[model samples]
Target: MTAQLEATQVASTQLDKNTIRRRIAWRVAQEMNDGDIVNLGIGLPTLVANEVDKDVELLLQAENGLLGIDSLALEQQIDLDLVNAGGQHIIAIEGACYFNSADSFAIIRGGHVDATVLGALQVDKYGNLANWIIPGKMVPGMGGAMDLVVGAKRVIVAMEHTVKGKPKLLQKCTLPLTATGQVDLIITEIGVFNITQQGMELTELAPEFSIEEVQMATEADLIISPHLITMPTPH
Candidate 1:
């Protein structure tokens, strides 16, 4: 490659540190409607709460009991009582309330959640997910992932393009399965993909990044949607 092309490529990738994650969150939020109750999975999924528009009355629900809240910036000190499903310290919004874990599961299992955003370890062409384990290791148990994936009306997954620089979205999952073909969407740093019957279809691509570039970033054979669009730039 010529030095000029290299420079252009480098400059294009020089996006805001949290731009990709926030973009994923923003897009996911766009799928939600007013008064829609949401359940955010641990990790990147939880961060979605912070990226939503303030005016959007998107109610936030937690499997660990809290509901109708927003994300709070972490402070030096922590509050043991107020935490996320991941057990991270958090602050409660004004009208936030809590309930029993069993009741929370019931809400999820009963399809009370309008939408759920979750992080995944692997997602196949057919939308199968493997987010609960790392093969041969069972230390971290599957919390409410199973319930949320199957119960929610829509399941959106937020994750990096790869793990340890390896593609997690594959033609077939090798990791212990979390839920079989339950994902509706997969948002990565490079693009937004949707799981279809044929394969993982690219719905949106990052700025200046082509569908070919995104395909190169993954080991999976990513198929671009016929109506693929470019992700909107942040203001």
Candidate 2:
């Protein structure tokens, strides 16, 4: 391929990946109810904040002590002290509050958070989450994920369906568990899965992908929902 064509392909590939991430974020944002106190975990979960409707009255909590995360701040507009748990600079909305880590943990551990969106390294058929570490690889220690998953009334995992073309949805998680049997729902680039008493149920699929594709990529046995539908593209 010509250099120009190669460059265009690279850009297109990056855009596709970003579109998938935004789609997952948008779907996760829709799960939030009005007046819900939601926590956005680091990485992909943080993208949900950008997709959230401004009219939705969500109290966005950051474990590092901010309580009302808005949109991403521009370089010149960023406040060094106003960063989220992931250390990303953010804009705070009106009625935002700040407290120490103790108070933040208090809110999370007390079950005051209505819902939490987290990114998972792997999710099993049983809905177990493994996000904190990869065995033998250097990783930042598990910070507040354990507390959020356990304390939030609802837990939604937003992640890619696969990592480097390998399935992330498996019969059992090979990595260390961040929280066991805690995930309620999972939103990925290709589909949505609901963790039910029976097992992981595929409820929605991206328009571009086929059920067979999803099945082939998922290592776990996926129960197809009778009402399975194609997920709408984000506006």
Candidate lDDT values, in order: 0.78, 0.87
Best by lDDT: 2
Write candidate 2's Cα lDDT for 134-165 as tens digits.
98999879999999999999999998777665
TM per candidate comes to 0.87, 0.92
Positional deviation of residue 2's Cα in model 1 after best superposition, in angstroms:
20
Q: Give me the runs in candidate 1 sitting further than 4 Å from their true place.
A: 1-17, 76-78
Cα lDDT, model 2, residue 119: 93
Q: List the residue pairs that clash in candidate 1.
A: 128-181
Error of 1 at 220 (Å): 3.0
How big is the positional error of residue 126 in model 1, measured in Å on the Cα after superposition? 0.7
What TM-score does candidate 2 get on C-alpha atoms?
A: 0.92
Quote model 1's TM-score. 0.87
